[model samples]
Target: MTRVVFAPDSFKGTIAAADAARVLAEAWASVDPGVSPVLRPMADGGEGTVAAFAAAVPGARRMPITVDGPAGHPVDTAWLLLPASDDAPDGTAVIDMASTSGIELLDELRPWDADSRGFGQAIAAALDHGVSRLVLGIGSSASTDGGTGMLRALGARFLDARGAETAPGARGLGDIASADLSALRPAPEVRVLTDVTNPLTGARGAAAVFGPQKGLTDPSDQQQTDAALERLARLLALDPAVPGSGAAGGVGAALIAWGGTLLPGAAEVAHLIGLADAIAAADAVVTGEGAYDGQSGDGKVPSFVASLAAASGVDAVLVAGLIAPDADLAPFTASASLTEVAGSPASALADTHRWLHEAGRRLALAMRGSGPASGS
Candidate 1:
């Protein structure tokens, strides 16, 4: 029997990683009944991180809570509660910033107003549950507030020149004069999952590199936010040049201030999900995400899986929602693009499951050496 490991990340706005794995497994099985598929949905501390853990870990529960969202409204969201294990006697809380403070939560980009308060509120809720450890996924952020809003929610005070608290979001950062962590809630052991390595301020830092995406397109705005974050780092006695300090619009720095350790999201998730072991025993490994582009090579799921497969001497295949024209697919044995199979990006996204099924079949056939040439 051919053993195939199905490890895929969420396809953004389309399919969740767990559902994508199931669909891929079904599709592969349909093409080759003898094939043994191991499903391991993946995430890089992004939008689907919580869902990935919930899908993979038995006895994981979703604890729903309402918090202020990025758009200044209450949003009902949930965090993952993993059952007690040898590593954590009281259990672990998996919180994702994307659920509360992500760009997706905004109707239209609120560059200056979007804040990480909602994310912090979620963390506070998890802490209240008495989780022994925290697994925080800080990705897809909507604000550049230097995590001041999050700190505010956690009882840290961000004061202006007159010793008054500032407003929320990035706009408030410029007014901050001091920070007080005296009243902050005591943080438990925190493991931050993030792929970002930029610092809190600089040319390659948070505001400069990520502000545009969060709607801080103006050069002046980016510079202002960057300066604010620099001030925040100084006020908190944090190293602004630390790797991952810029993650989630300076949420990384905030977590560090609260005694959290930063970890590579993809590798951490892989270890947690046992992807290495699964790949070792598999005949082939398949991985993908919403888009396979030049940037996907940077510690993303597909590249991470490819490395694992290579180490295990197994072939790695990729199935992407859309493969960029300049994407380098040289690491994969074969690759398939949903857009190519479905004929259009719109059609592929509209029916991701169906097209993904087709992609799976194509991959199965390719593995058996009976399909057409595969390359995107």
Candidate 2:
């Protein structure tokens, strides 16, 4: 029996990574009943990070909670609790911003008003449960408040010149005259996961590189926002030039202030889920994400997984919802894009699973050096 590993990140607005892996596995099995398929869903500390942990960890449990979302509305979400071990005496709490306070939680961009408070609230909840360590996935963040909203929820106080609490989100950044970290909760061992390495306040920094995506496009606007973050960094006594400090619109810097360590998101997730060993033993591996482009080569899910496969001399197959026209497909032995298979981008996204199923079938056949069977 040929062993094949199926690993796919969430399809962005459509299927989850776990669901994508399942769908691809089923499609492969339909084509080759003798094929052995292993499902190992992947994430890059983004939206599907928690779900990926739930699938990979043996005894991970979901702890539900309600917290204020990015749009200042209540959101029901869950954090993952991994059973205690010698390495982690009091167990581990896994929380992701995507479910807690991510940009996706808002109907529209709240560049100035969206906050990371919900993410901090969830962390506080996990801390209340007495977890000794934390694994925070701070991707898809909604605000550029320099993480003041999150720090506030964790017991830090951000006050204006008059000694009054400032407004929430980036809107209040300019008003923060002082921050009181005296009341902040005691630090627990924290590992902040993110693939971004942008600095905190310069040209390649958070406000300049990512602020535009969240609606702070003008150079003057980004400059002002960057200045605010710079001010916060000075107050907190953390370096603003450190790589990855600008991730999630300055949440990374805030976590650093809270005594957490920054680590590569995809690499960490891959290690936690044991991707290397699995790939070494498999004949071939398949990995994918929503979009594959030039940037995908730089620390993204597909490239990381493909690199592992290559190290083991295993054939790696790449599949994606959409493959940019100029994207280098050299990492994989073969590749498929839902957009090409489904005719149009709209058609692919409208019924993503259908196209994914088709892509899986096509890839499975291609692996066998065979053409499609009949109309399949």
- Give, for candidate 1, the lowest lDDT window spanning 10 residues: 367-376
Give me the runs in candidate 1 sitting further than 4 Å from their true place: 373-375
Summarize candidate 1's per-residue lDDT along 1-376 as a digit string, tens digits: 9999889999998998999999999988998999888888999999899998988788999999999998789999999999998988899999999998899998999889999999999999988999999998998998988888888899999999999989899989989998988999998889999999999999999999999999899998899899999999999999999999999899999899889999999999998878899999999988999999999999999999999999989999999998998888988998999999998988998898999999988888888888863435
> TM-score of each candidate?
0.96, 0.97
Each prediction's Cα lDDT score? Answer: 0.91, 0.91
Model 1 clash pairs are none
| Runs off by more than 4 Å, candidate 2 | 372-376
Looking at model 1, residue 86 earns an lDDT score of 91
The number of clashing residue pairs in model 2 is 0
**Candidate 2 lDDT over residue span 1-376, tens digit each:** 9899988889998999999999999888888899898888999899899999898889999999999999889999999999998888899999999999998999999888999999999999999999989999999898898899899999999999999999999899988899999999997899999999999999999999999888887889888989999999999999999999999999999999999999999998898888899899999998999999988999999999999998999999988998997788897888889988988999999999999999999889988888742121
